[model samples]
Target: MQTAAALRHAQRILVITGAGLSADSGLPTYRGVGGLYNGTTVDGLPIEMALSGPMLRRDPALCWKYIAELGKACLGAQPNAAHYAIAQLQRIKPDCWVLTQNVDGYHRAAGSPPERLIEIHGQLSPLFCQSCGAVDPQLSEHLQRPLPPLCKKCQGILRPPVVLFQEMLPERAMETLHEEMAKGFDAVLTIGTTASFPYIHEPVLRARVAGGFTAEINPQRTDHSAAMDVFLGCRALEVMELLISHI
Candidate 1:
């Protein structure tokens, strides 16, 4: 409730979210316990390597196997309270924008406007052809297809637009984030992320530099913990629920 005072006065806000935000929704972090990569693949490669662009290009079956599994994991996983809280904040403050590292698309599911929500890591739905760039939005349909689904347009292999470990971040998404950063914000709120990427923490650092309030909600301390104006050492869902009431 103490952080509500900062949000009440904030005109423009930026929220950065990560995998931890969706963990409560039954999705695994892919690195921690019960994660997709707690153990190596049958081929003896890390889950990160097995899901890279090169692997997708070379051995599409292997990559698609994990991709399909990820899709199944995301299926039926509803957005949690934290996601809805962010969405509610966006409605209360149209200037509030979410920059999420998650590819799960939960923010959108929670009613956040597509225009205000930036999926920095791309979403799992809308499979696209690697050859012709054709997009298939029916994830369920594609999931029912073969391991390495083919594009309807050119019969090329279809793949999700998610940013693989080896692939560069989507240019448009990064450019848009930088554009938002240039405009500046009144506050920065980070939820369930370690702030591992420079871009993830840059907004918070910039907010601090500009004298804006900055807060982080995580169960454990993160790299940005020392710099946060308010560090709520709690689960994002619980903290967000409390903060939303004050807003």
Candidate 2:
């Protein structure tokens, strides 16, 4: 209720989300690509290395072993109520935009407008070839068959558009974020994230400095929580529906 009150008057709003937002849908709250594994994986390598871009290039099979796990988890789960609530907010507020770190594509599935949604960490579907630049839509089918799915046309390794460990963020997504940042937001709401990355925290800081309302919705307190105008200490699934109703 406090978060809604703070944001109710906002015209331009930014809803920044992370893995925690999707965790309610039964997905692991991965810190980047490694949180599912504590320190090292069963393969005796750190989960970061196991899921890194370099590792994918070095041993596609080994890298894809973990990639396939992520794929299966995403495919098995559906978007939760919080996701739909955020989508609804976007519809009601034409200026509302979402910037998410999760690769599950649940926001898109939940009906967030693609033009307004920025998947900062990239997404997990429609695998593409690394070599010949071919696109493959059979992600679920390939996951069932092999470790590293290959391109049908070039026999190249097929991978999702997701940002792997040790990979740069997508340029276009970053550009869109900065562009919007320059225009400024009337309010910024962070949900289910620790605000660990610069990009994640920068928007919140910018909005605050610009005298904009800032709030966070998370089950636990994060480093950014103390500074929020309203910190709803609860899961997005629990509070988002109510927040949307207020908006």
Top-scoring candidate (TM-score): 2
Report clash pairs, candidate 2. Answer: none
lDDT of 2: 0.89
lDDT at residue 188 of model 1 (Cα atoms):
94
lDDT of 1 by residue, 120-152 (tens): 888888888889998888787778878898988
Clashes of 2: 0
**Global lDDT of each candidate:** 0.86, 0.89
Clashes of each: 0, 0
The regions of model 2 sitting more than 4 angstroms off are 31-38
TM-score of each: 0.95, 0.96
Scanning candidate 1 in windows of ten residues, the lowest lDDT window is 29-38
